[model samples]
Target: MINYLYQEQNWKTQLSDLITDPKELLQQLELSTDQLLSGAILASEQFKLRVPRAFVAKMNVGDALDPLLLQVLPHHLELEDHPEFVTDPLGEKEANQLPGVLHKYQSRFLLTLTGACAVHCRYCFRRHFPYQENLPKNNDWDNIRDYIEQNPQINEIILSGGDPLTLTNAKLELWIKRLESVPQVKFLRIHTRVPIVTPSRIDDEFITLLKNCRLQCIVVVHSNHAKELDPYTIDQLKNLTKHQITVLNQAVFLKGVNDCAEILADLSYRLFEANVMPYYLHVLDKVKGAQHFDLDSAQINQIYTELLAKLPGYLVPKLVREIAGEKNKTPLYGETF
Candidate 1:
């Protein structure tokens, strides 16, 4: 497990420690000379895999090789030309009923709190999410609070964005207090990649805030592969479990990422072990630039059947798709008994 109190090494220091020789770093993730020379100089430090100080402690210190760290490190040169990715792929702005409030579903509202993330995932469904135009400033949160106050039918408020946990503890506390004022909003869900990408975000204060909230809190984390859940992440997951937060995970099926039966099974098993329920294994949303990541329903069904054979009913995450304008995610191919 990762030690929360451990000192954090700066990204530069961390990279210096890893790169014994520049060529050695390139060999690990399998980059070509053309790939490295093009813009590798531009983001060389970023190329080295970086996990949070908390995440690093979870790994075997004796063993320098770590998988979770690699995923977050900015090695992919493809990110440079990803400008076509846009800010809002799903057109969430159109769905926003209020400045910071998005009523994409009937009973639930999504609040765009902050536009920052510790690490950017390449396969993010909202890679193009419009944060500049849509994000709520500290004072602007009143707009969201007022909207929810008026819409008593909204029982759930989803805290989203690049990642809501990126908000400071105090700011988050204020937001929760405001939301609690609305008696109708019974549930609060936080969709985040922070705990997975940077486990340091999980701490006593963070857990305490969630535990003390008047509304029932549920955390839906994003973890694509089993490798992403290291010892530090597991400890963080356990903290959420102890708090009685309904901890769940939703993974987007990515092609070069995790699109296999064994990897999917391991991801589910790891989540279960860490006390996070495996909720949904989502088929990639067909956004413009993410076309390479899409997996067809036929292949998804094959993996689903294989997963069923490997794990019990509860352990298997639903094979699902989220269609725009749909009330809920539709299950694509889970067999009925």
Candidate 2:
């Protein structure tokens, strides 16, 4: 642990120097040119490639079928032009009250911290999100704070974004301390992918912020496969849990990645090993450019059922679907939250 801590560099430095060109990323992994063809290159033009070197190192060199590579490497299938796979599949646009504030659930308010992310997964539901209009600027936090005060029923503030942990520790602590002033707010749920892709982000200062926050901190890490949890990532997760911060994972059930029962079971075990609970094994949101990753409910249920047999009830995550305009997430496994 001491060795790992001493070797850690600032994560923001990593973010600025990410591999933006698909060719560069492909070359870095020693992938053949045929694997990342012209159409695949064209597909990522809109979303753009944003993968850190730390994450690229995890991929299997020269293997196009590698799960980690398949996630970030955009394919021609993304341009399927499916009608149902529209932008804003979760209806987040409609719920956007203020620039940063999204009010959909009564008990919680989702605050869009920033549009920046360390890595952009091809299956990201927010691939088409209008960051220009969603991210708040100067004086926006003031309005968002007042809005939170007005809604006394809102007890949880969801720090969602491109990834909330991308912010500086001082900035996170300052803003979160302001959030603690809200008497109604009890929990701070930060949805992030940094720990999985950019484990260096969880440094001593980052852990300090988590420990010092007045509100109960829940770090919902986005990890699709067990392989994402490399030794460094697992060590960082241990550091998070050492501070007694609640760590949970939300996995997207992608078509080629972790679709099988055994894979999901293995993923659950790996998460448990790191003291992170399997929270939601979500069906891919029908977002534009992400139809390639979508799987049917019957298949999802079968996988979940097989997972139930392989592990204890607690290890199984809820097979859930998020329907736009629905009051809550509609569960496919007949379980309600």
Candidate 3:
């Protein structure tokens, strides 16, 4: 097990001190650099390896195949060019209306607050996103507010990014208060991986901020494996639920990570234990540098079939795929490939 010294540090300290070097990550896990180091170096140069130490501690030492490790560890396979895998997998650029604004679904308006994240998952669809150019400016809030006011149908605002929770509480509060000013925005949703990777980000002050918000708040966290939900992570998630903030989990079906029925079921049970509802079980987006994680239709069908048999309706997450230009997330049932 990794040292608990990181537990003493604040979330900001943990965020600033991510393990960026592939060699260092391998050494930390006690894995040899002979076979893995070179490829990792090449792949990381393209996308970069960023993972918090606290999250790294959850990995099985010396076992390079650990699910959590596979998610973040850069590999040579990522360097291979797959014709099917393009950078803009979801076609989010077309939906991007203003700086930091993505108007995909009709009622829900998404905002990419900042381009920073605590852990850089290898399969992230937004890895190739042009965050620097699209990030909203301070003055841009006026335009954002005007846009929301113009569209009275938009009742929800989703705060996404690299991860919205990665921002300081003050920054988050600034955005939240601005969203609250808009009478049309009845719900505030945050799509983040912070609570799972760095639970300390869900600090008391952040919780208080959420509690004080007039709009109903929802936090959709990403956690593919049951191993990701340690005691502290579970407690942090529960803290959100305890404060009347709706907490949900969305997991991607990644090969060598969470492809099996049994593993996905375990994750659902663990999420339920934390009072978090199992949300979407996403099929991997065919983004560049992530073809290695994709599974065939037959493989996906079998695993999801077994998963349906294993869990009750409430515990089973909706198996969905986001197709570019589609009105909604296309639900994959039975043999619908």
Candidate 4:
């Protein structure tokens, strides 16, 4: 059942107490250096290990190839210099308007709410993101509000970053009220991996905050495999759905984690069971250190085809890739060029 309803350790405490040391993480998992290739430890120097204890609880002890572990564990492969894979693969910097704001699409803007996350996946596209420079000043939020007020085309505000949910309820609600003040803004979307990595994050108070908000709220979460959905996590997700809150799950097609059709099919089935709709099944962004996870369009098409045969169309996520300067995500079906 794996319930995080413990009285002692709250989400914040668990987050602060995350396993940052790669050696400690390996020791906790009963793994040895012999199991990992050289540069695995050195690679983590660039983006230090950050895995929540609860998330690590999901990994199988002594299993070197555990899918969840594979996603977070630093590898020697990350050091490989793939010429195509660069730091800013999606060219997010070009669209960055303010320290924390990015007006990427015509009508939608993304706000980097915070540069903090409970888990740091090794293949994260933003692993090299310049968060320290981009994180806004305490009072700079007013500038963001004013920017929204000035722009009439912007209707949707996507709260992203390391993960928006990492902010406290007071902070989030404060920003939500500010966003609600903008008559032009109609929808508030949040992209996060909190629930999967730290299920206790969706406590009663958090749910109540969303229920009380006036703007149309949508929560998009990240979960690559079915195994991430422990009973407690699914219970929280189902709770959101029951409250009439729209919840969706997004996943990246990692070579070792969930590239297989069988695993992805199981992931879709499990997501539906948890009352979450399958959303974007993203092809890996060509970011440095993550080239090991990339899969071609043809491989993705075959997997999507299998998903169509096994499940209804509604359960299949749109397999898409984000290209630099593209208006929207380029759907993998048609020619990407």
Model 1 gets an lDDT of 0.69
Best candidate, lDDT = 3
Where model 2 places Cα greater than 4 Å from the true spot, the runs are 1-7, 334-337
- Residue 215's lDDT within candidate 4 is 84
Sorted on TM-score, highest at the top, how do the candidates line up?
Answer: 3, 4, 2, 1
Task: Kindly report which residue pairs in candidate 2 clash with one another.
Answer: none
Q: At residue 27, what lDDT does model 4 achieve?
A: 87
Root-mean-square deviation of every model: 5.4, 2.7, 1.0, 1.8
Note the clash tally of each candidate. 4, 0, 0, 0
Off by over 4 Å in 1: 1-33, 36-89, 334-337
Give the 10-residue window scoring lowest on summed lDDT in candidate 1. Answer: 11-20
lDDT of 1 at 60: 40
lDDT of 2 by residue, 1-337 (tens): 4325423656787777788888888787777687466756888887887888778877888888889988988788887899988888998888899998888888897888789888889988888888877788767878888898888888999999878888888778777887898888999999999899888888999888879888999999989999988777888898999999999999999999889999998899999988999999898898999988888777777778889899998988877788877877777773432
Q: What's the TM for model 3? A: 0.98
lDDT for each residue of candidate 1 in 1-337, tens digit (9 for 90 to 100): 1353432433323322333233444454354465444443444443223234444444343232244433333444434445444445566667877667779787898887877665555455665666678767678766776777787778999998867887778889988898898888999999987777666577778899999999999999988878778776788789888878999999887765676788888998999889999998888765544555656677777877888899889988888777667778778885431
Each model's TM-score? Answer: 0.80, 0.95, 0.98, 0.95
Model 2, global lDDT: 0.85
Off by over 4 Å in 4: 1-8, 35-38, 334-337
